[model samples]
Target: MTTTRSAADDARDLPAEPTAPWILVLAGGVVLLWLGVLAWQVAVLPERVPTHFAADGRADGWSSRNGALAFSALIPLLVVLPMPVLSRLVLWAPGQINAPNKQWWTATGPRLRRFERLMREDLWLITTVTLLLLVAGQVGIVLAARSGGDAMPTWILPVALVVFLVAIGAVMARMFIGGRYAAQPDLD
Candidate 1:
């Protein structure tokens, strides 16, 4: 005997809605705010600024203010611009998506869509966090330059690294556990 399931049935069996509108809006807003801050700082920064900091948070390298500011602005641009485009590509082409159980998840429509949605949300979140961190670091550098002292708190990079690692680990765990992409038994 053989059995067939409708698309509706497959969707019903899949997890509930995975994307949240408010979260996406909030993430976008943060990136915009960071851009604004970068622009404002670039306008007001001195002729020379610290381009690098020592482990002790003291300025170790110097550059033209415009050059340093441009580098700072570039970090967020690199993260904010390509992320959404790549996320959309993944959504449209699930075959290109990478994950622990890529084959299993992309095998069925409902599962593939679900995985894509989750991955998109995760990418947005990672982009937001990364931009925020970069912005914070840039702000610290500017403030330190203005103050003529350390360009960052020595603890900032270490703490940020820990947070970044934790966030990535959590996202990966959620993808594997919540996605449940393993082969399922035949309904028939």
Candidate 2:
């Protein structure tokens, strides 16, 4: 016997929870906070600031204070600004989202909603962590410069990159495995 399902039934099965507001707020707050820190630091920064660091964390290149400050401000903006927009796009147009089992997840309204929520949350978490690391690195650099130190720990950047990569890998693995195991709701 073939069973028939209506769009209403499918919609009813979808989770009702909207995107988590705290995630967006927290992500935005981090970006704003770091931007403020950058701006404040720039005011008191010396004439020349370290723009490049050697593997040992020693300053190898210098830029005008304005240039260094601009570069610092750009980092978080580059990393954090596009994430929410992309996340929203994923919700607005699931057909455009590229993922391993894309068709299966986007096959229904409920599945698509779930997928969008998962993707948005994942992006927010990743964006927040990355921004925090970047902000910390900038703060360290500025503090070192203020103290007349020519070197910041060389390991900061490498460690941050490794952590970021690992976090992304973990999130992707979780999504792929979860998607593989998720029960596909019958649409018939």
Candidate 3:
């Protein structure tokens, strides 16, 4: 009898990925919504808008409305848009993945699938949180522009920053834990 490699085994050889988890799709949707909000805000912005904020949350510098819009759009595009590309890169080049006990993970089909699922989920989580933070930033920009050098709501940025940091850290830690699972012999 000849043994044949199953489709799952062949999957490892393919450059294409399986269907994305819902969270990744959700992250993409959120970014699209953010672009919509930015466009609406740009349409309403005055000719001159505050583009920089001081340590105290008051506007310290100004720019033309177009300049402010360009700055805001450029940042999230740079920061958030690369996530899916990197995720695909990792899938295509699993050799780049580092773990304390990667041998066990790559040893079997089930373990490898589990390892990949965790990686994809963690990536989507990171992307979603980053999108949220960027959206918050754009909201602050619009509010500051409306306020005309007035102080922003004092607690908002600090609180949001801390929350986003904690959330991302937790997701990263979960990814590390996947290594632990990978190192184990399968009980199945």
The 0-to-1 C-alpha lDDT of every candidate, in the order given, reads 0.69, 0.70, 0.69
> 28-67 in candidate 1: lDDT tens per residue?
7987878787887877788988768888888888888878
Determine the backbone clash count of candidate 3. 0
Candidate number with greatest lDDT? 2
Q: What order do you get sorting by lDDT, best first?
A: 2, 1, 3
Clashes of 1: 0
Compose the digit string of candidate 2's lDDT tens values, residues 80-141: 75674565565556667787777676666676656666766877777887787777778767
lDDT of 1: 0.69
Model 3 over residues 72-183: C-alpha lDDT tens digits? 7887778766664564443445566685566655555555565666566667788778877777777777787777555566666787798799989887776675454446
TM-score ranking, high to low: 3, 1, 2
User: Which 10-residue window of candidate 1 scores lowest in summed lDDT?
Assistant: 179-188
- Of 1 and 3, the candidate ahead on lDDT is 1
Error of 3 at 23 (Å): 1.0
For model 3, what is the alpha-carbon lDDT of residue 65?
85
Q: Model 2: which ten-residue window has the lowest total lDDT? A: 179-188
User: What TM-score goes with each of the models?
Assistant: 0.72, 0.71, 0.75
